[model samples]
Target: MNREKLMKMAGAVRTGGKGSMRRKKKAVHKTTTTDDKRLQSTLKRIGVNAIPAIEEVNIFKDDIVIQFLNPKVQASIAANTWVVSGSPQTKKLQDLLPGIINQLGPDNLDNLRRLAEQFQKQAPGEVATQEDDDEVPELVAGETFEAAANEAPSS
Candidate 1:
């Protein structure tokens, strides 16, 4: 072939042939709009600032507790807004007893043990039951007060 034809062939080979002339398709990612993202952006505009030196966050909802360890916390006191972002672990009150006891320290535990012993001694075979209207009813684990009230016998 001619010099020009040879050069063209050489160029095609260098550029990985005719297939390389076509543009490669880009990867398409489907993006979804979420309420969380909107709320975050709004909060940012409102001057919400990150809270520093926060170790942990605990939110109690009735008998359930939501715990976050080493989480990002943001607050805007003027706006009365607080935001905590982290992987949450939900635990019942019974499950958190050990941690609560440890936090109470040995001194408080001893005092609590003494109080329990005294109470037991005072009422050996008698279980305490509330009769007054002001008294709160005993609730089972995972049972809400409203649910317990509904299950209770109507007077």
Candidate 2:
């Protein structure tokens, strides 16, 4: 019995134990949506080719920056369409201000300080009111303004 048990143990060790006969689970891939498929087909027909070897892409907004590392880019000059696909990291301009200031060095820093001081010294009453300006600004092409009644209330 002891000899038989030893042989069984050695066989189990060689064969990676009891569950080794079970097949590994298949990896599930993401299925593209109908819209994605349609867009890809349309792009192919329109001659929108992939722009390769793009290291990074940055999009700047009023107060934030969107960064994509190793993004895939595609563009068609005729269609005037550009597409960027990647995981984006959003960083606030406020968060980046310190780094920018450090890069500007001491001379620029002094000028910035002086400007800030001047701004602070100005009286609130002296600030320009909307009625004080007579110049009418020209509207840009394809620009439209929302009615004040339709605007959402700020918190």
Highest lDDT against the true fold, candidate: 1
Q: In model 2, which runs have C-alpha deviations exceeding 4 angstroms?
A: 1-32, 96-155
Q: CA shift at 126, candidate 1, in angstroms?
A: 15
lDDT (0-100) at residue 21 of candidate 2?
Answer: 60
lDDT of 2 by residue, 1-155 (tens): 69999877657555366556634467987677977999899989988989999977767686697878899999999999999999999999668667556656688899868756755776756875567467675564655576543575867
User: Candidate 1's error at 61, in angstroms?
Assistant: 1.1
User: What is each predicted model's overall lDDT from 0 to 1?
Assistant: 0.79, 0.77
Residue by residue across 42-154, what tens digits does model 1's lDDT show? 99998899998887887868569899999999999989989999999999966885776766778889986876675677566765555543676465479897998899999
Index of the highest-TM-score prediction: 1
Clashing pairs for model 1 are: none
| Predicted structure 2: clash tally | 0
lDDT of 1 at 56: 81
Instruction: Tell me how candidate 2 scores on lDDT.
Output: 0.77
